[model samples]
Target: MNKGKGRELRAMLRDWRAAAGVYASLQWRCFHQDGRFDPFLDPATQYRKDGAKVRAGIIRQIVLKHELDVPVPEPVKEGEKPKKRVLPTPPGLSDCLAPMKAALGAAQVQMVQGQVIGTLKSFISNRQNDFVDIVLGSTIDDLGRRQLFTINRATAWFDLGRSVKVETVEIPLSARLLARKIMSHILARHKKPSMKRIGMVVDKRVAELEESRSATSHDLWLKVTVKSGDHRSRRIAIPMRSNDYFSSRQGERKKTFQIIEDRETGRITVGVVTDVGSSFEERRMAYASRAQGPKALDFGLVTMFASDDGDLMGREFLRKLKSIDTTISGIARHVQRSGGKPRDSKRYVAHVTRLRGFITTELRRILNRFVAVRKPTTIFLERLNFQSPELSRRMNRILQNCGRGVLRAKLQALNEEFGVESHEVVSAYTSQTCSCCGYVDRRNRKAQAVFACRWCGRSLHADVNAARNIGSERFRSIGSARRVVRSNVLDMLVTQHVQRNTGERGAPADPRMSNPHFAAWADKARLSTKAA
Candidate 1:
């Protein structure tokens, strides 16, 4: 009795309720014709006119977003964008916006980048439990409509835990007008459209022209174009000191070019610089794969048939209904060992599509920021190899986790067409060897990230040393892992085996595969203790 009384007292004193992370696709119409600025949604068109159904959906999103502790998105202003300005929007909404951009970037993001976009499943935790979310926008629902909450429906699904499937529902509505409508209404609440609005808006105009720059050879200044077609380009400059590391000369037609080299070791390492005219197979593959949608699964009917009056009329009446019906349905993923994979992903199709959308969009953003070339520069990376007897299962799993194969595939295609990646080989002790003291000791690496040399007391990031060795170091002529530059027993066999199989002589895939220098690098760094 006392415990129950205490609980009742606690419930009566709570202040805030749950939070909402509402997500709605944003669309901006260039009201100015010159693409100078995008206006918020037109209230007269969205709320005060024919798009009544669309307005209600937007309102419901608003209520749910608030419930998730996420503040409502402000309207898009005349000159400002939501993503750049919303640097400080509440955390939940910001996170939700990320996957949405990945999943759907004005439909234009999907067409340009041939990859999967992830879903936008926002999380809304309870800040306080005092009250439940009220869905009618700024106004209470009518008595009949209010009952919709008591019986489980759309509103209740938001409360499901992390794994529940909540995706972008294509309601046969226009995201453009819907976005504008939502933005307009939010702006109205502020009396004036503030600068901090539409933090999630992806201007379609900006989306379309961004890929055009990929056509340039990465040897000049990288431009960050904002408000495209309106002639606004914000270029970020990367200075390549034109020395041995970055040098250039005229070709047959006086075409100036530059070679990029290592900063410390003075070795030439190439960077991403694709030819504008080259048709990269990577892009082709991306376009091809984009045609193949997510692997699907199908499920049988799960719910009892409902009557016209909302009454359940079937054998499952005695059982409690699932709070969420058909939210995350799929065929093969959910199928048991005894049950074969489903032929189609009829149930959770929306979720898969949304998730893929998110991934592809994020990838596009990464590409936009890092994939650049002005001077034919180079970067040295240790060769990645998983097909080896030395690799443990967990180590293999970690390599897979890095998605090296996929990443390589992407870069390979890009480089082949553009000639951007000009990787070279130093073939030295990449691991178990110290770049500074020519020490090699497998035990020198006490941790995955840390490497300490016993002979010289020089420590380095294990991976960094490995990358540097593949660029500048040379053959030590020893066939061991105990020196700064030595070859491994595995390396010896691999070079020969590779030659025999492919008739092409190359060390292991790692640039340091059979480099002569690191023969004793590992022995020099070998842990006096036994190999762990």
Candidate 2:
């Protein structure tokens, strides 16, 4: 057994040497063509001339000992698939050694590839010392990893350590301290819950949603079936406009609106096409729900964080960045291999940065709008602190570039200047519980955008519901096991039910209408519209 094991280990070592020799020969051939150490063709011809001869002799011995008759794989032609190989392993070697051999070969290939990239970098038109610095920094961190540093794109102006020339206002960190003082004064003045202040925002949101059906474009309406907790079926029509529309690559788009339905229960909202074009009015209304929606604010400043799906601040923006990064990476790889011009890399990066700027700018606008409308004494956001070592580099990059931190910092500065309160919420389960009933159940949220409580049968838009819950967390005893229902919650449920039924009923069969209740509702709606 010892002899067999020894022989196996020897065989693995032999295979590794053979793979390394094969890679070295390929590298040598490329170097030869590039006119490196010319006139010294064979190692034997030059007797100890340089290190190249000695290294070449070692590779030659390995190649000869292996007695390899295998033809070198042909260079892949443009738009052509390379032939796959199924090389048989030596009898004494195990499959475990395959990876080591592949790694050795890969290292050799990269050595040659690095030389090629170095040659290409010299040809860059506007290459500077800063570019060289970025390259060296990346190489020092992980020399084996591929770098996709684009210098030509529109966003190239935001290069690391470079001064950005865009006009911007500077808000001091001391503004937060001022905001805190103002919030403290407000708290001392009013001891109880600020239900009236919250009610104002809530009333506006509900009225807007109610009126939006008629005001919204016919193309923006979506009819979806969602299941109630009581094992009943319900159909709801919502004025839905998708926000996930930032695609970085040409001909590549992410599915922002996905509806996952439960097969047995049929308690899910589905059948919405997110690609439909949204008008200015439609976009304004959709964003208004979150940006200016009613909230149960216990503090002057509210630190809003994500529930289950993702962070509200930069979800769509991150999706856009991801799309752009994928496209840019592909372009970089293609350009790097084919010896393409630097302009191509710059162009792709520029497009991505422009899209990113638009998202961040819009996010700032929304935050500013919220501060202006709400005029809170102070605000606090639910801080996102979760991190795992298992996460991939790609995922980490996405999270970092998604602009959550940037938005948070911007909101702090903007609110500080306004003397509005701002802070962070360290609580959990912001999305699962119902603000009305205090019911905590994962099943309550049937879909990403739909929330239905099992305890109170309260159904509301998921994000709106979450915002309400987040705002009211400090004011209400959410930890209490007993279900607490509110009068306003009852009214909201009734209104939603009436709207859904009336919508299904469509126009009355008679001019007078059969349902007197609906007729009264219609009369009230008409009066409200005229009042507005």
The TM-score leader among the candidates is 2
**Overall local distance difference test of candidate 1:** 0.32
Question: Residue 294: error of model 2 in Å?
Answer: 10
lDDT of each: 0.32, 0.41
Per-residue CA lDDT of candidate 2, range 251-306, in tens? 32222232333322322332322232334335444444545333332111122333
- Top model number, lDDT: 2
Q: How accurate locally is residue 403 in candidate 2, as Cα lDDT from 0 to 100?
A: 56
Estimate the TM-score of every prediction.
Answer: 0.25, 0.29
Cα-based lDDT at residue 506, candidate 2: 31
Model 2 worst lDDT window (10 residues)? 197-206
